[model samples]
Target chain A: MATAVNFKSEESQAELIQLVSFNLDREEYGVYVLKVREIIRMSNVTRVPNTPYYVEGVINLRGKVIPIISLRKKFSLSEKENDKQTRIIVMDVDGELMGFIVDSVSEVIRVSAGEIQPPPSVVNGGVDQEYLSGVINRADRLLVLLDLERVFSQSERESLINSSL
Target chain B: MAILCEDEELLEGFLAETSELLEKLDDDLVALEKAPEEIELLNGIFRSIHTVKGASSFLGFDLLVKITHKTEDVLNRLRKDELKVTPEIMDVVLEAVDHIKLLVNDIRNGEIVERELDEIINKLIPYISDAFRESAVLHMESAGTSEREKEVPASPVQTELETEAAAPAQERPRIEAAPAPSPQPPKPNSSKTVARGEELSDNTTVRIDVKRLDDLMNQVGEIVLERNRILQMNQDYLARENTANFGEEFSKLAKRIDFVTSELQMQVLKIRMIPVEKVFKKFPRIVRNLSRDLGKEVDLEINGEETELDRSVVDEIGDPLIHLIRNALDHGVEDPEERVAAGKPRTGKVVLSATHEGNNIIISIKDDGKGIDPEKLARKALDKGLVTEDQIAGMSGKEILDLIFLPGFSTKEKATDVSGRGVGMDVVKTNIRKLNGIIEIRSEVGKGSEFILKLPLTLAIIQSLLVDVENEVYSIPLAAVLETLKVDTSSFHVVGGQEVLKLRDSVLPLLRLQKLFGVQGSETSLNQSYVVIIGVAEKRMGLIVSRLLGQQEVAIKSLGKYLADAPGIAGSTILGDGRVALIVDPAGIIEMEESGVTGAWAA
Candidate 1:
């Protein structure tokens, strides 16, 4: 929401933007906590019959059937066996509850406005420019705050409705 | 609630009730033309219009009330046997009904129709038997219950109306519903009729928010799934473990839960079931005006108006059905003189009936008129470049009839404003297919055409036949599945680089699921494997799958924005084991094949 963006762009250190951070390959990425509904251990994901390679499948989160997207495959990152550290961070993408398979979820941290800066197109870890929102320059490492909306745009959601038709 | 809010609420209630009553009134008034002395039908018509007037006056729709009052005057005179139900009088009443519908619709949409009601009121005046006839009957009708008017003086206006028409007469405490600036409304006028009176109980049914009922259905779905999961877990443990007594008790408990959960689910689904009468009611008037416009005569016989369907289906099926009826009146049914010269009944019969066929609802519109001439349709198809002569040579009679559904292929040489614009049947086909329904056409050149539509019982949940193509499970909605086959390898032959399976004498196009979805699977499964024969209308395809997972009732859920437009995938469903499976849209698969990369199925 704009509130989270406002917190990032504001001057007050007291106003902090909360983000849930996770790993794709090596580098860390963060999405606003508001977009992250929940994070759970990866469970049984029945493969959808016909979909893009990156679309791992879908998982039943409680009773709702949610399609899952694999970040590793989507961003052309190296793949590895899913270990105990793997977590499916369920995010509300345009009101649909979709799960994102991340390496693991780290601690939820709050960063002030001045800490965030526009992302550079060529990141050292080689992440796609479209999915990056801004770089949160944390003291330990550069945290890339992802733009969930741009990653899954309105056009995609419209296709979901059209596909179901 | 605020005063204005309460007024709007009451206004909403009144509009819903009146519009429904008006819809039924349209059919009753037309029926009265044939059997003019059917007093009960006349009473039904008069009471409907009277109720609308009374409610409109109370709700302060002065214009609407006045128009309906004029309409009621004519209808009331007809009821008193002082007026004849002539075609001209029927036109005026039907016109008034249309106008009231307009005003009511506008009012329902929160717009006060500013157009003067003088034209309709004036049109109704000539039809009124005695323009100066004392409204003594309506006034005297109110005298039937002066006792109730005395009992409930809180809303003297409504109390006065309770006697004016078909009010229940026995008012018990008034219910005091719908927020009160008007203290309470009079029982909301019983918007729905009691379906049967054979087994009479208290017979009280409460109005519930449709959203609440939908929510209840979803929750019931959740409970059913949860129960299935528990039963599966217990049965597996019992089979594997050495706990004998625990197994006995657990099996018994699972059986009980299964029975209760299924009952709960069925009851919840039934709550959303509404008779298709609401959709059928407006047709008589529609046919009336249509026949009048074209100078034709049509006798619309409606059967099985009481066939119940899920409310969601009822809401959507109305438009498509209307267009089909229009088609029948325009193209299918012959003009009155033409019918007589053809040695047929003077009044063409258009039978609109709904019947429950197993899990699906089959609504057929059968017309006794000139059936479609395939040669003409084939020539039209050729002229429109919709099909080649070579394609026509290979087509069957049904395929030629099916050409009407092809876009831009209307057979009418002279385009009429009624139904021959060439866009309706295609739209009808598309809309019906959108509801996961099928539209079938059957006709003989001399005999009439019947447009049979098979629609699902509900939209949210569907019984799906789940299949596996290489370990990946896909669901084919049971509605679209024609049948299943374990076709031998010899039945499938390569024809011009495309696989065609000979199902007896007919050649069915073969769609390999793994190739369609681009799923990586063993091609060997195609040999002597399970094939789901799915069809929409005349286009049938055999979908090859690895395993048949049996049938399961799945609640359809949309894939969130990311994977929304996956071709051949309709929506996803959560299986009993809490794993997600994509619901195969058979219609979508056919559309994709036709529109995109055709013959790309060659692996």
Candidate 2:
């Protein structure tokens, strides 16, 4: 919803936007702050059989069952070990709550909507361009704004799983 | 229109009350068709229509008021015996009831598509049995009348209706309770047949939205889990050596909390239950219409209508029950002449009954008309290519009968709108399966046929036996678990290259859960293992597990939309230890077993 608002606001001026950025396999990916419900430490995840390989399984979120996915596995990046900084970012994707496992959490960053450019044709971080809403060029490092909706879409997961099979 | 627009609540209240009254009216109307001389039924029908008329008139729903007002006049004449009950008269009355239903529904959706009320009113006018010219004059005289005159005082039946209606609604337990002072002989259940005998009338019910109950159930589920966790913690605390004296007090408190929570959960589950009569009531009307249309003499006897089921199940079980009843009437029951020729009674019997079996509800639809022929069903399946010659040759009689549930396998040569297009049975099977229920067929070639459906009483919470495979736990609903036993590896023998366990008198197919779920880490205890035997319909399979976690009351939680269709996994639930365990879908695993997914064993 915040992304939709940002996109609409782009017509008049470059509105400032907030993103909850995190690290996945050394690549900085940011999701709109409004989409992020919370960040919590990694907990026990019960593996569910016969799901997509990237699905890390499910966790009990305050008596609710929430599916957790491995962003590294999802992006086809080299898997990394969970450390002190590992966190699960619970976000709202198309009205359903799903959690994504990331290497570490980063500080909230503000970037002008105009500063975020269209995803380049050849991205080097192994994240698909379609999943990237835009690339943000911060002074210290490159930040990729993620379109969590597209990344976690039903058809996208189904097609990916089917192709892998 | 202006009044309804100004007070939508009044219109809504009218719609709700009228719809319920209309449903009861359907059943009463059908029963009246069978016993046309029941005065109490006539009076009750008249009062219900009069109530609808009163409410609609108050709401200024002019069209509804006009139609129901006319219906009331016709019913009043019937009540007074001024008009006789005949098929043509019943048809017109039922048709008017149907139009009232449409108008109520249209009002509900905020659009009225101008039905021809004049035609039905004119049709009902002839049944008034009074001089039409005189009645017209009376109607004109009553025009612009006060509310009291329009509502209750005008009709002669009103005075008697008021006295009876004011005699406490609590005297009625069953909506279609046998008429008071019934002229028929006493039924076996004397309590039910004895009408209006109770003095206590304090039980008043409030109408609640189902969603509110669902939310409350979820909250109670959370409370149950929290209580379980606290109890587990207290046990851990008591197990330690260094414990304060308060620990005993704490443990007692936890125990009390546990008992209270369990009671609370049970009560909430009870609140979610609705008597199966909500669905059963509609069937009499359906069977009546179908039998009349087919010109067959069939009697629908409903038993165990008071069986209570979780509301969700009751809501879904209606359609399948309807279809099965239709199937019984349309195909199972023979024509009156055919039955007479076959040396059977002219009035074929179709029994729709429900009964509680342990923790499950078993609803059976049985017909005494004509039983399904296994060979005939097999021939139909073969013709449809639903099964091959080899398949049919290998199947038993029950399996052959089961072929009717296969898609596109119908015995009827031509599709009839009344349940013979071959499309319904399979859908029925799917729907029952979705409710975690199993449907079975019991038939004799010449005697009769019965379709029995066994369903869990509640979907939200169930008693499940949790088992472990490679330290990963799974919960199998105890309703499906017939028994659990510790068996030696050597006792298992291979039959036709599939693992089979000889348990007592029967050979049970063995499915190793470790192999089916592909749980990582090899099994270290290879000698003795636990086998949880589960069955649906007539097929049973013994699931081999490493350790038994005993029985638990588990609240079923979905795997969410992302992993909703996990194969062999029914759902997920949180254990007392706060870890998630998958609930095994025994039916799905049974299907897999049929599909030849039995993993290879080294034994």
Candidate 3:
């Protein structure tokens, strides 16, 4: 997922997609670097009662209260206790600032858009196909670019809740 | 290029000044109709028009200058006792004022105003004497020649025509070329204009861009957060102190920081305070025009124009207030003949007023017209198939009265231009709800109906008392919270599977935080739990939480569009301890409290 951004002259001519890669469970996922406002170490996230299971709760980033969702829980991966490596990536998704908890934020990398391709029909980690945008090869390993917008889309949540009701 | 830049700046100032003057002129002109002998108000109307004319002529807005001059002639005649104030003449003056307003608006868009001015001028010229008319013609001729045109004065909030007339014309314009000309041609009648113009200003104030004030407010908010972080760090220091003296010094400094930040927040909020008169000023013109058009004689009285609200609230609330006023006139007030037949006064009375009650501002529009008959409303609802006959039968008079707010509910069979298609009241409700406000209607048959719009003082930041519900923290706006106390669970009566507590004489319905938010947790029996008693207008309810946290000032942040309509959650705010807490919606809670007003409904 690459959001539009103004870049330096060198990068201007290049079809580069900058992403912040993070480790969730055993998989490495990348989201548009422009979407990430900041990355903070996992801190006290007050549990918000009566929210979806994946919404770990909210945390205070400066004076702004932003909702935090666990990426592992969101993807339905097995839940694990927070470790020293855990980081909360604060992002602005369509103007709403939110935080996503991941095992660790690896590095920010710029990859060519031409290298990235659409995902296969079924993928690893038991993640829903609708949340997957594409997969790309970085070095020798495969880097999964997550569609954060679709992952946290409201329509999907409502439909899920509607079916349960 | 410099001239172009200067012109843009001058035009911006001109628009702001003219609009403000026109708003006040509207009130004064409407008031003149009621008390034709109030010479101060007549002069007030005259001076405002004169001020507009002077500024427009200086700006080379020849069309606006010409129009206001003619309007000024009519007003001057009325001021000179050369003409009498009649309904027809008052209408002519108001119509001229209306055209002037249109011209100012047109000039604001950088377009030359070319309205049908000759017809309006012909109507106004009858009120002007020959000598005054000839002097006006001479002034217009000289206005075109640069040699005769004086150097335009530096922008003043209210410029007088006499000062413009007195300026020394310079062939070449220079920055700060001349000091303001002394008030000129001091005629005795001119003194009256002076007397009227300066009466409205007792305290000197500067007009500031609202955006700049908002930026300052936001910076102050950031300072508060920084202070909180400092306090938190100081607390950490106090917790593990190696040297007591050092800890004491740090604590004192932190406390000082806290005090200064609190004072600064107050100062910032005070600057954002705007008088409610900005909104109220436009209503008299609306009422006058509306009553005249509807063939109903209405006496619209406005009071408490001095009450202040937050700048943002003042900007938003005008249209909703206008809609309610229109509804009051169209439906609530009846025709003069109908009033006479009903043994009421021939002229209907509508009182629009504003007054602060505690932290909230209560603006009520009350009309002494044909009061809303609940029976007729019920019949209308039935005809519209909005409610079943049995449901209508079971409803109380207040409940039936509320049906007017329901969508697709219009009292008038024929749609009028004022409030068309019955969509206004529902939209009014939604708009007030957006501002965290409430609109309540009270009516008596054959009497008038009163629409009370209760609103918060400020929407951006509010002092909230944060509380813990299980593991989650939620904030209750301090303005809505009446008191917090522990109540025995045994005192709760489970009526029809819904829980309510009897607090002294009143039976208070209780909404348990866990149940309201649908928290997935098991219930535990306790002797007592902390309950925050909250009030929205006249309704009160108890919110049961696990613990009561201390109060803090919260800068409201929107939860975005997807969650905007979420029930019970107004917004989210960050706490001093670096944790996010949801700000509960008291209005929405009250709505839930009212709708599920019945025991089973609550369940």
Candidate 4:
């Protein structure tokens, strides 16, 4: 029990990383705690004209207007209806705030850096390896760590092309 | 010597005060050149330099002190009538002032680079009177000796403190030497002199950081949004409630809040308003220098310098305005001999004026010289293959003149460094369009050409006409909206595969927003739809939408870098019920229209 509590507090350790995990199409994804600003329930996003299909448009985050991206559309997964479980994970990437729509937010999970295995050459569910930082195996599920800088910076349309190929 | 002032606040204050003085000096020096014997102007110039010298000396910036001191002595001699103001003398003085500006910027940036101060200092010394030069040397030596002897080398701050105390005492002898009835030297603590006849107007204004004003504007935007929400809620409340007294009191309070919010927004916007003269200030000097360089006798007449615009607009207009004025001087103006042979005055006139027209500011640069010849422009465009002969044949005179603004178009046989290599006018047009400004050219061959720029007052907030297209709302800036009409679809005609609607005498080209944006929805009504006519420069287009959602005052917010350059969307603004609505870029849509990319209009 003492060891378990220490593992949770080990986030302050140099090699341990804390991530805010969320669900997208039954797949668990984790982004660094530092990058995740806040999670908001799905709200009305104004549709932008003449943008990529995956660009969900923009939403008013407080007084600021920030762009929203649909992770499902980005991964080429079938579109699902946004219900109570739909949440927008707002992340600060390169000083810009962008919100990503996911199925639901799970919890803040702490993991040892060694526990994260490098992503394999191929991954399931149409997600590109370029966007995956690593994969961690839990007792009953797998948590895929996402490199948001790559996921948001690299154009989704280009990634879609790579995935299709 | 390296500057080592520990107090960041004092250094910042000195930088602010001195930079403001330097800007005014640029205008004053130009005016002094035109009227060399204006004593009040001469005194103001002298006082500005003295204040700079005093402040820098306090901050222990030895290099700035040396430059401003020598320049101050020259200005003192000019004011005392010991030295005459000639082009040669003004050139050296302006050079010194420019160097001072550079040094001040260096200190502000926190890294002092080495400058060749000896060259400019040597040039300024020749303009100083012999007696003042001798006394100035004596004063410098004494001040230098006292500083070395009294202050320890370890404590630079103490030395700066002593100098700050001694700065005014040092100025007294210099002012006393100028004899009676000259402008009194400013007090020790106050480093700035009252500029000319203007009364000492301190404490009436505060020097605010622009970022703070931007924050306040954002807060006001939020307030405006909240006010809108309240108004909507009150309407719903009044409609749903049967309690008359409760509803009346709630509405009275809402009305009061609404009025207060509008006033607050206006006041905040007013704080960001600066006179266009901030940009117009540099022109006289530029004209003087460029006209002399070009050997063309030109007179620049400036009017409506007091017309105010947003500070953001003021900042961006400086470069474009300079290019336009230079174009007028270089290409539009004729040489003295040419003008005389053409039966015109030897001196060409370039009138630069600014005035408020409704919600827009109209700035025109009108030159009385060799006006643009449209036939020549057309021929050139054809040769360059920018436009074909058939296109030119169909264009009017004004449209042909606008061909100059097309990219890669230049009328000059050879590019000159003055007006830049051919890329100026298009870039100018693009920049103006970015501000939602319209640039129009009106010219008569051999008479003159006038380039009129109509710019919105502020980029932050605008009165936009909101329209709904397939359940998605968009805003069109009312400044660009000519009028909205409910037109019958059956009356529309397809001419040459392009949709057109004949409204009165003009055949207005129509573009459906739903089709343009690829909006997937059925038409609201097949019988009739709303057409919003928008005019950008000379080209007019009608935008068809499902419903007209009246007008709104919207605060524009950027869609971040990822979605920054979406083709037809300028930006997004949050609406009354916290929904984001995109602001349509009419200019961008027009570009799409010319490219034939947006699909044909649908009934």
Q: TM-score for all predictions?
A: 0.83, 0.84, 0.76, 0.84
**Per-residue lDDT for A74-150 in model 1, tens only?**
77888878999999998887777888899988989888767778777676655677678788886689888887766
The digit string of per-residue lDDT tens for model 1 on B511-560 reads 78877766675678345868899987546788888889999888888876
lDDT of 2 by residue, B521-562 (tens): 876667887899997654678999989988999999998877
Q: Model 3: clashing residue pairs?
A: none
Instruction: Compare candidates 1 and 3 on DockQ and give the better one.
Output: 1
DockQ of 1: 0.52
Clashing pairs in 1: A160-B564
DockQ values per model: 0.52, 0.60, 0.38, 0.48
Of the native A-B interface contacts, what share survives in model 1? 0.80
lDDT of candidate 4 over A1-165, digit per residue (tens): 122233334463347778899998878999889888999999888887667778888899898999889999988989999999999999997789999999999999988866776678878799877788778898987998887777755565345323321
The CA-based lDDT of model 2 is what? 0.77
Greater-DockQ candidate between 2 and 3:
2
Deviation in Å, model 2, residue B393 alpha carbon: 4.1
* TM-score winner, 3 or 4: 4
TM-score, model 1, chain B versus true chain B = 0.81
Which window of ten consecutive residues has the lowest lDDT sum in model 2 chain B?
B194-203
- Give the winner by DockQ: 2
Task: Give lDDT: candidate 3, residue B52.
Answer: 74
TM-score of chain B of 2: 0.79
Query: Best by lDDT, which number?
Result: 4
